[model samples]
Target: MLLIVVLCAFVVFLLVVGVASFLRSRRDDSDERIRSRLGALAASDADVETVEYLVRRQMSEVPWFNTMLQQMRWAANLSRLVSMAKAPGTPGLYLLLSLTLGLLTGYAVFLLSKMLIAAAVLAGIVGYIPIWWLKRRCTKRMDRFQEQLPEALDLLARALKAGHTFGGGMRMVADEFDEPIGSEFGKTIDEINYGMDSDRALDNLLNRVDCPDLKFFVVSVNIQRETGGNLAEIVGNIARLVRERFKLHGKIKVLSAEGRISALILTLLPFAVAGVLFLLNREYMSLLWTTELGRSMAIGAACSMTLGIVIIRRMIKIKV
Candidate 1:
């Protein structure tokens, strides 16, 4: 029944896509439609302290939804996440999809199981699917950016050493590397070319990218602009430092692999055992939910599992 509900939702999504494509096909060129939304990507919020930044984009295409989302703090965040990930669809669209899925899945679960707890839990997880996928994509993009940063900075430093101007070096990096470093630097270059200050452009780049090492590079550039210094040498040192940090982080991750594996096993073990017992003898396993004392024990076990997960996560996560 839940599968049917999900399939129905997916079918509706396909139908919507088909209608949009059919309408788009009537136009001589759909490029305009694509560019229309592309131009609305990667906007800055006006809340930052350093610059009185403009809200450069809207959260939704629908006027009412856009206006409603404008009042939400998290809506902007979702916009930022989508921008960073270079993912399709608006925050409002994602939220609407999540809500729809949650309602459908929750109703289906409640109808089948007749348990409010099961319904709510399934609903929450189903609702979070879009967000989870977006975050995963964002994290992957950030990691790629982080790994590319050192080499990009080195290339820029070498360009400077070869007597290329700062802007020229930036253009070189933008043209040479792949996304997200390439696109991010390209955006900065575009901003600079369009009469925006270099400082502000770099700040915008840093805002779009959640990389710590990029901060060092941006701050160094800003400081160099203020005080006269060998900018190329400073960038070179930053690249070396970033590489060293990467090495150390890699070592730490390797060392903590055991703990992470153990945590994963520990987390899934209870669910696995419960599932097996339920399959082997449904009546015996049903005691966990059927009696008051059993329910209390189950709740206690859940709390303990949550606590263990938190502790294990903290232990394995060593920040450089």
Candidate 2:
């Protein structure tokens, strides 16, 4: 009982600390922005103070904890995932959430099953919930961005035809369209305005948005800049192509709808049946968890089901 109490206390402490750090980071970011503007306006002769100020501004409020996590190999990847998901929390906060979830889940399972192995497995799976949620958010956001890309391109082409510069056209798109697309383009414009190379800024945009249509637009712009061509015409053509591709993609999804539905039913049937059986006759279903042979068969069935699910998913996934 004491151990459990201590563990719960530790988890709560971690959560409180994580929340505090997250709020502090938000405040610090605003302060950093102000300091950056001041630093920019300061005399160049105060180079040493400027450097020190910049370094201090970049450091996290909880230096030891943040530094330890940042030094971990997965930290960079987690940060990228958080950025892609457009999550408000920092990577360290996300990690803390994951850890808390895992430990609480493991403890609950252990209490119920009195089995370390079962607890560990459940804990591990639960630990990935945050990452799974992040990936899903990123996927949906990217899908929306892709859906908006062709229209954004057309808007840009019109802006260019109206005698706006490329940067002006980008700013127009940034101002006119809604999120993900607008925000991404706005970021690229900010980079360009801040003296980043146009190609580099666009490349960064490409890296952030993971849309093939956007890639085509970026490649076209780069090619136009290097080899010389009518920018508006090129972008217009790319926009048209993207629209056609999207149409074809819709047709493909329609054609694959049956296969996808079948896969979903097939994947869920086993679990659904087992659940029903457990509710109807707990003793009969208990064999699967209570006996060695039954446990082996259950594991084998799970493995086969997982493999089948993967194969079915691949079969239904049509790439455009």
Candidate 3:
């Protein structure tokens, strides 16, 4: 059947993608990669004529397409998001992948429903998956960076109390800590040493890292530079505050477990019932998708279910 052919092709595509991802993860050249990116940060200064010639970021490998993407702000944002996520592949490459998958899925849906509008809408929605995946990756990386922040701060505080200079303290953190915090601080130090203003370097780090707690650290350091304070004590206090917040975050997660479970059950209840009915009465359940009116009702039910899930998730998600 056409459905089988389409599904088989999709499965092949998924297999290829999964294998590629596994291989990339196993590449494990992160140290050299970190050094190269840190080196780039120094070279990318506005003062460096060499930086102009360096291919810092390309939205696409293709000349015309890259030029077109350069003119599009959203595409540039996507390229930046990829960098922040430390993800491989250009925006153009991901777009191509999404388009291919969307076309495959849309064709299959068309084959089943013979509905142009529905197929097109579904294709558009599905095409966003790759971008959504990149954003998800970025968020997870940022969360990891945040989790590492408190310890990095404590390390820096210890370095300062041991009589190291501010830059030296940062260098110690860079050498001792792991990524993304290590690479981030190392990059900031590189920028500052390479003639960028300290403020500018820290601001660039802030842009690269999306942790709210880092903002407190940055603001504290800046204030210390202006008004003068025991920087070690200040940083140590921030570290303690961050750890306390983590404890509170754990408590919040425990408290919200019940709402999460309820939401999950509510979301799954319809699917469980549908499965039971299908097992008990295949012909009746089959009519749902096998007829026009049944298809319309199925679409309505799907939309309503999606809306309900979104509302429930929003209700349960708590911010730290």
Candidate 4:
């Protein structure tokens, strides 16, 4: 009788614990959903459905932690580009893999360095270096993509004027022009024919490209759909505006090029001198790697070099 009573008590305890756990999990999931929805609302001025769609699309591409990392990367990248901005890691899984490689490289560099503390400090900076460079490369690519957009729109307009359907014109661009702009438009047309709504298809294109200029292009098209207009004329105007902006930007870049080159030389000179000195007179330079005073000097040199780089970059960046 006592054994039967004890068994019953144990079973009841287990059942109670399981039910509590289940309730807690349910609450946590609900809280997460609410938080995500709030975040979506904050990030975009999109309608609830649109925001939800974007959130789901992003979530599907990356798990939670990775999504957070990519967002952080995007913000950092956007801070640097004064002309056109973009979010990171939307194009390819290669970006995520590059991040992992960067992390490993940082770890290896840390392991190899003699000073554990400095190594760890440098690890984070080094890890982000690859990501920063990748962001720069992507930024340039996106700029080219933006530059091509207005021209492509004009082409579509011309094709339309000649009585070709929108999809047929897009196919022409895809066949005639280079990636990634032509390819992106081609994908949009293909998706539309595959039963996707034009709005949703364009939205997907916007996400894939993730450029502010491209966003403007997509918004323009969607608005034009609801209220009829001479699309070719609108596109031509956009093209003219873009060309003028690019001309101004090109002039600014040319003016700043000499200063940038000078900055590069100044920044690299000290490091080059140090390398030569270390190679030519190891005994004299050994103090730097071996002594605390030398270490302090090394740190100072690094900090000053970093400050100079930042200042030079700021000076050269003339926002249009």
Candidate 5:
């Protein structure tokens, strides 16, 4: 019975993965969808064109995985890959490392499996898990940083109101505010002062953040350059809008928290139970882990778990 359950789960997981991949690919057919959303807001044509170009370029680069990754939050992952390749790590080296990890992990899992099919599957899954986890971590960290952006803007507005130049106010925010946001903006300010054009520095900041609100801000600054309005007041209004948007987003997340938690628990419970069983009754669990029947069962279990997770994630994901 235990073997049967595991086999069922694994098969289901495979099917779910297939479906999810298919759906993501289908959705990507309309790259225009994402662009249309951004077009609604007051953004410069140049900025919008740049965003559109990047999106298309990235989509072309990862043709298979880019669409699915939209929900998986992998922008930070992609950015890190770019930054690493440019600096300490070489692109060739990173690819080689991923390949090495994949091969070693794949071989180990293949050796452990009682059946070739299960071994192959497990090896592939294990190999990518580390990279997937790294991507998730980077995404969450970026989100947290973006969350503090409104606060940073508010500080800048206050400083400007107090008769400081825009650059001086930005420096004060960098000095007085906490890290992540402070560090990012401070770097931008530094770049600007070091002879980089303000517009280009601002563009770099927008690329780092890829958020609609920030895009609106950049556009506002450019437009005000020719029109010449109360710049401080405009920033204050942007700050207020960002705060309200964040508040609304928080409310939506709170409402969905229960479902999200339930999904997580459900997805994890089976693996946790399996671990306990292995520790307490090695002999009993060994047949499933070591025999041909056990390998099939493992495959099924993986498939089922994958399906369940995808379904739950879809259910709880509410776009504001």
Candidate 6:
């Protein structure tokens, strides 16, 4: 009874924290929008003091905990990952969410099975859910960016041929392409407008986007600026090369589809069989949980399965 009460109280605490975090984030977003508008108005009015004060106040008041977290190497890496994924939320918020989920899932599993090892294993897996979600989002976004890049390059080449400056060509691409590519180009143009060096601005764009094809465009532009070359022709050649690489990538994926599907089926087969056996005969399947030898065997099998899955993944992954 005490355990049940404690569990319920813990769950309620987590719910309250989650709700408070959500509300706080929403309030902060609205406040930021208001402040931006006010700041713009103050700037136009030439109220330097007001603008300075607003800037000072706009800085988040980081608590000691968050400051310490930000100082850690893992936190820095996670922050970079979040930025790459274009995920909305601070590193602290993501960490809190992961911890809450892991704890809740572990407690629930413990309540159901009364097994510490199983609960811990499940908890660890649940803790990685946020990271997995972020990686998935980042991958899809990069894929979309890669798909849009060849056409954007072609547009830029055309703009250059029409006698626009490089910056003007970038602006044209920003205005012409759809989101992600358009937004990225728009940001680069904004940086250039704000007096940033063109090379530095392009480097910043590369830092934000993890597309290898974009490197060819950047390198070609940099080289052309150093030497004398037809910029339009160079950019056109890059666009054609990117298109060919994309085609090769598609062919590779198609060829590996069977291997990927087989790996997935093999990975899930053991779990499916165990679940079916449990449903059919609880006592017979319960040995895997209730006995020492069964537990050891289960651990060994899990480790072997994980190693096999990794090997299979490496075998099928083809880099273009």
TM-score (C-alpha) between model 6 and the true structure:
0.85
What would the per-residue lDDT of candidate 3 be over residues 197-304, giving only the tens digit for each residue? Answer: 788789889988878888889999999999999999999999999988888888998999999999899889988999999999999998777788987887898789
lDDT of 2 by residue, 161-226 (tens): 999999999999999999999988887887677666789889878877778888889988999999
lDDT of candidate 1 over 1-320, digit per residue (tens): 79767857765764464344334334333543344233323223423432322334456555676789889887889989987887766666667667767877887887876667767878988989988989999999999999999999999999999999999999999999998898788877876765567888888888899999899999999999999899999999999999999999999999999999999999999999999999999999888777778767887897899899999999999999
lDDT of 5 by residue, 211-303 (tens): 567776788877887789988899899999988988988999999999999998998898799899999999998888677787678778888
Poorly placed runs, candidate 4 (over 4 Å): 1-113
> Which stretches of candidate 1 lie above 4 Å from their native place?
1-56
Task: Name the better of 2 and 4 by lDDT.
Answer: 2
lDDT of 1: 0.80
Q: Please count the clashing residue pairs in each candidate, in the order shown.
A: 0, 0, 0, 0, 17, 0
Off by over 4 Å in 2: 1-13, 21-61
TM-score of each: 0.83, 0.85, 0.82, 0.65, 0.65, 0.85
> Which pairs of residues collide in model 1?
none
Please, what is the whole-model Cα lDDT of each candidate in the order they appear?
A: 0.80, 0.81, 0.80, 0.63, 0.64, 0.80
Residue 88, candidate 1: C-alpha displacement in angstroms:
1.0
| Model 4 C-alpha lDDT per residue in residues 1-320, reported as the tens digit of each score | 69546745654554454344334333334544454444335334446576555544231133553456346656334333311233332322333333444445545555555665566556567546645676677678788887787777678778878888767877887777787787677767766765567788788777667566566567777888899887666666766776677788899999999999999899889979989998999889888767899888888888888898999999998987
Candidate 6 at residue 293, lDDT? 88
RMSD of each: 5.7, 4.0, 4.6, 13.1, 12.4, 4.6
List the candidate 5 regions with Cα displacement exceeding 4 Å. 1-97, 210-212, 276-297
- Candidate 2 — what's its lDDT? 0.81
Shift in Å, residue 165, candidate 4: 3.2
TM-score of candidate 5 against the unseen true structure: 0.65
